[model samples]
Target: MSSSASDVAPRRPLLAGRGLLWEAVILAVGVGLFFLFPYDLGFLSRILIMIVFVLSLDLVLGYAGVATLGQAAMYGTGAYAAGLIAIHVTASPLLGLAAGAVAGAGIAFVSGLVLMRAHGLTLLMLSIAVAQVLQEVANKARPLTGGADGLRGIRMDPILGLWEFDFIGRAGYWYVLTVLILVLLFLKVVVNSPLGLSARGIQESPERMRAIGTPVYWRLVWIYTIAGGIAGVAGALAAQVTALVSLEVFNFDHSAEALIMLVLGGAGRLYGAVVGVAIFMLVEHVAAAVDPFNWLFLIGALVLAVVFFVPAGLLGLPKALTGLVRR
Candidate 1:
């Protein structure tokens, strides 16, 4: 039994290697898009930003097995933090990103202390409440957050103080793409690491993990905090590239959309986040253009199809098809 278990464990490392290879291929495709669709850079950049946000969600909900619908809480917190720093402190893009990351992690850490204690629907409700409270606070702090009008006048310095942000968005595209790749690479390492494996173990059988002396609660808090920082990086990128921060960043829709994207691609698998965002956004763009009134109906249909058929997500489609053929 021990030998069999050890043999099975090695397969995980092999899968990890394959996952990294897939990420590289995805990165190549993303780079090719810049030259292939220069006119759609703005829309593509938004997808890249969403990729980061969805990836962060994958970390908590997918890997840690924490069901949440309030990731926007951290996302909006990061956006506002970075935007305010840029407007009041300095225009350095890096600094703003750092501020956003720190602010996001801080909020997650504080909230996780309480929120992590709950489970099932209770946990989900508390998460939503945190986001709602933050939203209300932002709405009331008219002087600081810009309230309903949105936060504006954000000026970001050039990348490394060299590459200027042109009107065409080429710089922003490359910048966001680079950041996404780095984050992806970092997370790839993370999910394959011992820490990541432990998270997965906890997800599969928390009682067993606890029985083995794992500090499940603290681990969850750590991952949640890290995931929040990643989400913050996404929000900061949006603030800098677009030069505007809005309350909509904290909206429940943002979280819902992210969850959909993650499910569409296949959660717990890092590559799913990127692929899901790309597919969903492309469908949304084309569907909305085709029928402005009922684009969501198309999206809903797609989601239902995925849930019923390719339940593992788009990433698992090939295997799903293979199994079907074998049967």
Candidate 2:
């Protein structure tokens, strides 16, 4: 809680070479699937966007010992920024994306000054409050955001003047995939850096970290800001794909979904973010197609099953299967 706590950096990942190899392999597989898939680029693109959101959550809730339910605040900030940029500044989606990131990060930094001060339920409450305020702002900004009707009129230029976002979503899929890859790489570097190690130390024992001359509070604030920036990127991705920004961008459900995806995938493990998003999106797609009115019940049941059977998440399912085979 002291200023000194914020001075300490986060802890880095323990594994170096083997971890990099695994990450490279996974990235290659993900890229290959994006290119090779024939029927469902939209679905995959959505998954990748959600993966970024989930990873951002992991950074705060899993790595930095902050519990928040208002991540959608940043996500919405990014989405609105992208939409605003597209509509007002330029039609270039990449420019809109950059604008969104800047807006998201700026909001995070400002919000972090206050939100990062509290812990436990207070932290959660502040987060929720932040999102609610953003939602209210979006609802009231009918002129700029089009209010509840949503901001529509965004026409993006071809990505890099080459690939256009199509109805088929092929280019969009690749774009999201590329961003996800870059975000993951950035997160890897961050979690392996000195700052990340301090985060881990704080997570394990904030009191101890503070006692040992670590700046626990500021470290948490810094991590929260970073995560918020990432969440904003996720929002920008969603805005790009949907081509609109609305009050729903700051909705409670958006934040809750990000949390569910993070928990479903597994906390602390980076790949768990992707795995959680993939499974969550796939289940939603299949289940909603089958029963639109009651898909949530099925999802709840599946989440319960995961809690009981594969607590580590869908990512751990493969390792569990391998263990069974070995046995």
Candidate 3:
């Protein structure tokens, strides 16, 4: 083996164990929150769902260097698809999640073909346009999507026909948490795989990557599709837990807020997504409760502070501090 390869092989075990350590921390924190905030199980579930959504965005925007604002389009598509499945086809949650994933991936793969061709402002505009068109269609399809009122009549069966989703949401909380952990683990695997490394290379320099024989566009498309599928899972979770699917699922704020959280937590790191969601949601909750009408001011301030003072994001703060201390 080459000296570099030989040196790297021994560290693989350490890295893998580190990954497991982080995941264990997440699991412990999730369980603690579950018991501590039993009254806010529903809210906690929302945070978990959004964590999944932001993680998807991290894969595309942070790792793949894809600038986008239409992610909610895939998210809403999955939600509506899942809702329709539950009402017309079956009440099975598992099947509904699958439908959501497929719907999100389908939209992402189709739209990514065109969106990937554009760059800078044009790409952003095109992405926004795609989402706008979908939102309009959902609004107009009154009979199918319930238009402005939202998709109602969704009834999710117990998870695996065993754990009943009861009134207080104990079963639902556990279900969403399990999904979040699985998604996190899956993403950890993907981000460390060849495809993910190729994506990073493309992000660093698409021209260089292409010159080296990487199919840059195709790599992006695959990454975007994967992200969309994960976002769709988040959407499906939202629909199942709330027992309602609405046009608001396609709301621009959802995408914007998710992006903001991702940025705040630090985009490139997987744990950043989780931390960002938790901190953003927690602060927003407290701020809104305290200010009610002017909570946006606090949120804006927080984002600005992070951007100016901690460009590497909250997760990178430790490194930043260490650098300063050493300096």
Best by TM-score: 3
Q: Summarize candidate 2's per-residue lDDT along 1-327 as a digit string, tens digits.
A: 998779875764555666677568767877787668757887777788889988999998778867789999999999999988888889887888887778888888888899888888898899899999988988898898999999898878889999998998888887887888889888988887888888888889999999999877777778888888898899998898878788888988888888888778887778888778878888899999999999999889878887888887877788888988999
At residue 135, candidate 1 shows an lDDT of 93
> Alpha-carbon error at 217 in model 1, in Å?
1.0
RMSD of each: 2.8, 5.8, 1.8
In candidate 1, the residue pairs with backbone N, CA or C atoms under 3 Å apart (3 or more residues apart, or in different chains) clash, namely: none
In model 1, which range of ten residues has the least summed lDDT?
Answer: 7-16
Model 3 worst lDDT run, 10 consecutive residues: 6-15
**What's model 2's overall lDDT?**
0.85
Better of 2 and 3 by lDDT: 3
Candidate 1 achieves a global lDDT of 0.92
**Residue 108 of candidate 1: its Cα lDDT?**
92
- Candidate 3 local lDDT, 237-319, one digit each (tens): 99999999988888888888989999999988899999999999999999999999999998899889989988878998899
Model 1 Cα displacement at 314 (Å)?
A: 0.9
